[model samples]
Target: MSEGRHEDESQTRPSGISTDVEVGAAHAIQPPRLENGEKRTDTEADGQNDQVELGSSGRNTTQEKPYSVFSTNEKRIIILAGSLAGFFSPLTSSIYFPALGTIAKALHVSNSDVNLTVTTYLILQGLAPMVIAGFADNMGRRPAYMLCFTIYICANLGLGLQNSYAALLGLRCLQSAGSSGTIALANGLVGDTITSEQRGAYIAFASLGGLLGPTLSPIIGGLISQNLEWHWLFWFLLIFSGVFTVPLFLFLPETCRKIVGDGSIPPPPLNTSLTDVIRHKRRAKRGLVFDAAEQAELRKNYRFRFPNPLATLWILFDPASLVILVATGLNLACFYAISTGASAAFRDEYGFNDIQIGLVFIPIGVGGILAAFTTGKLVDWNYQRHAQRLGITVVKGVRQDLTDFPIETARIQVALPILLANGVFVIAYGWTVGHKISLAGPIIFLFFLGYCSIASYQVMNVLMTDLWPGQAAAATAANNFIRCELGAAASAAIGPMSKAFGQGWAYTFWALIYMAFAPALLIISRRGIQMRSAKKAREDKRSARRKEKMNRKG
Candidate 1:
């Protein structure tokens, strides 16, 4: 067997224990052999004292500190900040739903022309993350977040003041560019702090704010547009975002593993928050400084690179990733079709006013909120069940080597049923609207639609993060790219489709499209590992060639 294959086998051995090297340690101590005469590496040893001696405040004092050194409480706080940041993306989009008609009237444009704003927003939403996510992965999450908020705040200011249709269209794109990257950045934060075993619940919690946006925004928008002018909507977002951005700027620390490395290494001044500076000062007062040599080494390893938008597209070249992105994108497009059509449909069919239209969205939004909490727990439970069945010992706060694990099965199994139910809900929701049935029929279907759609979306989110360990943001950005593009297309087409085929058939067509992608999930569950292994082999070969070229130059 090849030496690399031997190492892989040793790492994945069922009886092996997981461990980590002490941060700042010069070298890891060799581990003893197992009963089967297999030697363990430092990462496979049992009960090694791998503590990093920084201070009581920012050190990993235990051997089982997982892939990250941040405590559970710290991880929650970080994810919470990221979640709040992510909230603005969907909030900004959905809040505008109620104001679309009002804006169309004010700007002296056709409703179709106003709808172009939504399409452009989604286009930027897909494209902006391709740049920002790469920058976050390379630089730090804090800086990238600050950049997003600054741009968003400015765009909202312009949007609130602008009167012309041309200005409205341009500024909404700016608004999208500012808000869209937060979802991707939030996913990256989860990957930095949480282990895979705990990631499902953590990601779900992190997603709560974003999920709440669709649920709450329209009601808020309705109130704003009804009581005040449509311009007040942008002003409200500006003030709210500014208030939230202050706390984030003051408290949120840099959690990027590349820069901080499990919270032990101090980040550069550019990446450090005010709270980080204060913590370092306190640690310094006690004569506890981080090892200068280790800090220098981390800096050397994390050389700055310009954000490469093309890199996001490169993820699509992998068949496994492509399948996941396309399938999930189609699901999102179905959602867009429902959401984009709801306002007009309710206004026309049920004779509901703006407030009532917003109120009707409550069911779908509530469904998403419930799904976030429930589906997250289900995903985690399924992971643990898989671990037990595979005979792999899962240690809390320690990263599990999933090379031999059926992670696809663990995640997708939770989503497959949900996807099927979502299709049913879509069909039901369409016919209910088409028949001009009671409000309750569409409302009830909307609830289930939101529940199943979000549940399936959560599963895909967790799976994508797992597939790309360090590059969670980029993976999520790729997901956002595909989904948002499809959503834009769906939003543009839904009105025409509904007008031509009637609501019942229009949604039935969408339901069928969503179901068509269902088999792709099964393909992933069965062959994903083989595809991943092959991709890894190709990556390893390229790495070897690069080393050989550098050696020849030397």
Candidate 2:
């Protein structure tokens, strides 16, 4: 390699190496020869070029940004906080189901009437995140988190105290609003803290909250309702919210990249770590002092602004994003629908009590969790494997590009079989349940059902984060919005469809629905390169324009 700077005024464009440089900066790497056979940098001094270039030594060097500022423990704590934050609404909703009959009887309402509350909760779950995600993405994750927790804590207290049916309905909606955004925020935090190559495992771990919530809900609810009063359920949630809220308020650092800038940039004082603050206070009490300048340096980079939720429309409208979103959304709907109908179907056919019915959900939860953890590791491994094969250098701790790296295949190809196999499990579960087979029959498939259902979500989620790491909160919120809306629909319809079509045929239809979306993944994997290239080109053009405008201003 040889060093050169572009100095020839006659050379106006790039020769084999044109890139949008900073305003007032000259090209650092001139081509070996121009198109007309002239050297552009043959007679130039160092000039005004601020860019660095390869030295005559021929050693390639790149200054790469470190992955994040937070320590490994800090990262785990962040993930833990995120998982706990996300665990509420779904778990609460499912847990509340066990108490539904008890509540209806105590309140002098029909069971059917109480079920409407579930519908309203799910609806609000879908709608609330539409606006709430903006607060996390644009405003600040900390404020958004505080706001949601405030609402959830208050709503749970209300639900516990309220004797009227309307209160239950309204409070449930409020609770949904408070809790549903946790998944989106958790996802955003992952984008904020983790690099693209490592996001899969982190995402899978974060998603476990959602998976465990519904899975554990019934068991907790059944025991509470079976032995104690029904209102204790809400009381329990209220206590749980308060307990979780303290750690979040005290220890959780704001990880929104828009405000924090990947931990390299310090966020505002408000976004500083509660744990750090507490440690500082305790240290000061012991006559110890730390460097104020060091503390101040971190927060100086902090900024605040309203993040637009509508910005997510860019990812949502993107063909690649849209396809994956739909696939995951529909797949989750099946999970919700099956969960909804499973209670009643099992109760009616097997003569199982509420506790026994709740136990049935454990297999799915266990399976889904196993899949999530395993899939995450595999996602990272698969990425490395693909990157190696594609000759894409993944410099350790640096976020590198795979623009032409066939990431679609790396992300989806292996997961495709896992996805397609899920449908088979669904159909099997349906038939087994329809025929009233042995208990182990349907339960075994539920495990696999849980396993396969989340494979696409885990894979696609990491991809979405990779696609737009900056606005990850917004992107995830859009995904949550899509899937929750679909889940609401499935939750509402599963029971009726089961009775109308018979479980066997009804599940067959759902199986086919999942299978129908498989082709979309295939198409996306094939065409993803072109899509990403066009996107990169557009971004490059924009960069060029911005730089040119800056130069004019200078």
Candidate 3:
């Protein structure tokens, strides 16, 4: 057998609790056989004292360390990490908005050329995350985040210094490439750390960033762009990004499936070769033992190359994922319709400046904040209500029986209101703007739209996360990919539509789209139980095959 294959066999056992490792540990003085054909020296033994302690007390000792798996404090920290990561995408997009007019003037470029920068940025922002999401699942969260953010930070620096539009577009793609990882990995990280019951609140926070970053960013960017040069806008982002990253590096523990040793769940295996393990052993003999889990983790399992992106594409086009795609797409179309419309519409009707335009986003912010803050309590309440209604109770956090309170119920409840509200407001805002209606009329309708949009958005996000329990990040990434792409298209196309068919007719068309998405929500809600049953049946068949294989081996 090849040496590399031998090492893979040796390391691929559960928890490194193999008979050989344990037998080696039983001996006190003799050096164990190193994979390199060298004996472990005394120096190495001294350094691995903590790992040796694993055998003490018959392997039953537990320490009440301030941080341990699944602790309450650690959960909060994980949420914060996920939230910080989610904030980067929207921050990058919105931060540039208030500076667009200035960039056009400074570069002596046409307004359309400057707007292309925005369009280009949005396009990449939609595309890059899907690629990054693929890597993150295979490589684990930490490597992906570190690599992506480094590019992001450098892109901002280049944006501050570069004068050419060509350079700016290239750098913006890099920035978007980096920022894209934030949303996918944030969802992945939450999956890494949180259980399904606790997932609702964490998902709520992750979804909240879609609203939070846009809300705060425009306000901050407006102030900077109005007073300082547009270059300072990037400087502010550079500084802000550092503030979050520094703390993350210091305190954010690695929660990747590879790093955290367990066998119940599967992750893409390590990418190390046998020679690498031998080299590590030699280094360990020189008084440099890698931390226990790290050494074994890298040695275990075969290295995975990138999976076919077609699998995700297949999943995206699947009936289940498609429902989410369309629901979220409408949500996106409606959301960007308001956000994009805000600048030209409000400026034309209410005569608001960039700062005032930024301020008007506060209603969306307020609406999102209220929905997210209460979603946890609301989700839990619904969970309990469904449990009681269905005559079931949870024991030690696991439900013995699932109640009628399916995740889709939340989708239906939220979607209906958002659809109706968004549809009405689109028509109202268009008509009110078409004719000279009261300035307050459009704004009032928008505020209600904000509340409804966010509530629906939250429900869809949480439902997607629930449906694909193990692969929530991939699912959410797919959702984001569809939503942003559609939203960007709508933002560019809406103006043309409004001009071609008049504002009233254009909005009536949008209302028709919103109304169409509503039935998708209802269908998911109605068919959820049957779909879940089908999924369970397939899993049972897989389990039976695995058992038959084991029986044959035995």
Candidate 4:
């Protein structure tokens, strides 16, 4: 998806809420529009003027609303929905692990073959996000979420009954497809609803599910599998997912800019809506009314472009973003490595049963809970303190005069405890595990490891959203894609990697990698102000040029 193309277009009033399709452009990208009832160009307006202007492109360019106007109720709904949605995918992923053995035995497949099912699901989960955001960005949050839940339901049903290995593999992939959308949409919705100051806290809460789901899944799965048939796992997920979807359908208002006006930009103006316009044109051209949802042609446009699975590669390549990505990836990799390796390691070293294995995961869960609840308050305090130190207003008020706000201070501030805790605990955990130390040694380290990992994950998550507010979903999807890919690779290779290098030595290497993220954090902490100011300057200039172009077009 080009940064210049608006995600949506509607034809009705001359002005509604026109969102800049520009993701991180130095110029104002025009929203996709209709010209004489046909699709027009996607180029953005050039940045050469000093006032707000409309472009030949149909989008209305205007100032952005201050983030403070989001009502308490609105904020709660968005956060809760996002978090719940985000939680489902991870919940399903781990919940199925304990059942894998049973599934293999029932399907009459080799364990290794069954393991491929897990690997395939993981791959699909990582890949689904790159494309789903484009749909949510264009269609509306409600529809995208509906589709995700629909997929989730259907797959869970199949998963419960499937007897063949091929059938299981197919259904699992579909399940992952549904799971992918939850976190992807959650990040984007939070971006829509919260301010930079409060965003960390919001993300921290939403991320609870991602951390908790995995931590608790094995335990929950083990309990269910031990007492009942393994199929009950899917049955339970089906019921819970269905219940969650009902309220979500009823209360989850569209948070996409195209659906709800943010009070700054005017909506697109045309005589026909995006759907009607596209449908009519297609009928005129092909002598048939094309179905937008199943229209093979239209859907192709929404598919993930290959060769760049990480949609944020450009963003990641930027020296600043690269640093962030590496640090965040390290944070993710370390935790996943520990968690992934834990089950096998525990069974071999401590002779733990499935139930006992689940119990051992409690330290990680508790640590995550503490960090998640605590980080919210800490983030708010940090934001307020920064505001006071900088002599900026410390109240919930609009910034009516500025083209953009400084977001880097908030971004870098998160790195403080995130990098520190993550690095220290990882090394400690590794050292203890490597030495085959006492259970308390490993358990104590798990506590701190969970704390630092979740804390860092929350911080890195919010920072990514802050860096590119409009593209939060895609940005997060990109984060998910990258970190998950790295984590998956680590999972696939760690057994050999650890074996080649002693467990202690292997972890020591991982610890070194975790610590390496510190320099990146330091750079961002030190130079974040300059980078943010530069970004703001460019945005201001683009907004000015957009204003100039609009005047000329009018």
Q: Among these predicted structures, which one has the highest TM-score? A: 1
- Give per-residue CA lDDT, model 1, range 336-410, as digits (tens): 888888888988898776777778889888999889888878987888776657554454444434555677788
Please give the RMSD of candidate 2 to the true structure: 9.6
**Which candidate, 1 or 3, has the higher lDDT?**
1
| Candidate 1 lDDT for residue 352 | 74
**Of the candidates shown, which would achieve the greatest lDDT relative to the real structure?**
1
In candidate 3, list every pair of residues with a backbone clash: none
Query: Which is better, 2 or 3, measured by lDDT?
Result: 2
RMSD of 4: 11.1
Model 4 misplaced stretches (Cα beyond 4 Å): 1-70, 99-118, 164-166, 201-204, 263-314, 395-406, 532-554
C-alpha TM-score for every candidate: 0.88, 0.82, 0.75, 0.74
lDDT of 2 at 100: 67
The collision pairs in model 2 are 138-307, 266-298
Q: Considering only N, C-alpha and C atoms within 3 Å, which residue pairs clash in candidate 1?
A: none
Ranking by TM-score: 1, 2, 3, 4
lDDT of 2 by residue, 276-329 (tens): 566446545765443344434433433454545565555577777788888888
Residues 254-294, candidate 3, lDDT per residue (tens digit)?
55544342111222324222333453456556764434544
Per-residue accuracy of model 4 over 1-554 as CA lDDT, tens digit each: 21112222221111211222112212221221211222212111111121222355566644332332335555665677678787888788777665555666777876556656666776777778777875676555667788889999999999888767788789989999988877888887876655455554565557767777867887998788778887789888898999888877765655565443331121222212343344335435654332233233223333323323334444555566667777777677777677666765676677676677677778887888888888777766766665445444422212111122234456567666677767777777766776779989989988888877877777777767656656677677777776776666655555566668766666667768768666667777677656656655664676689889999999
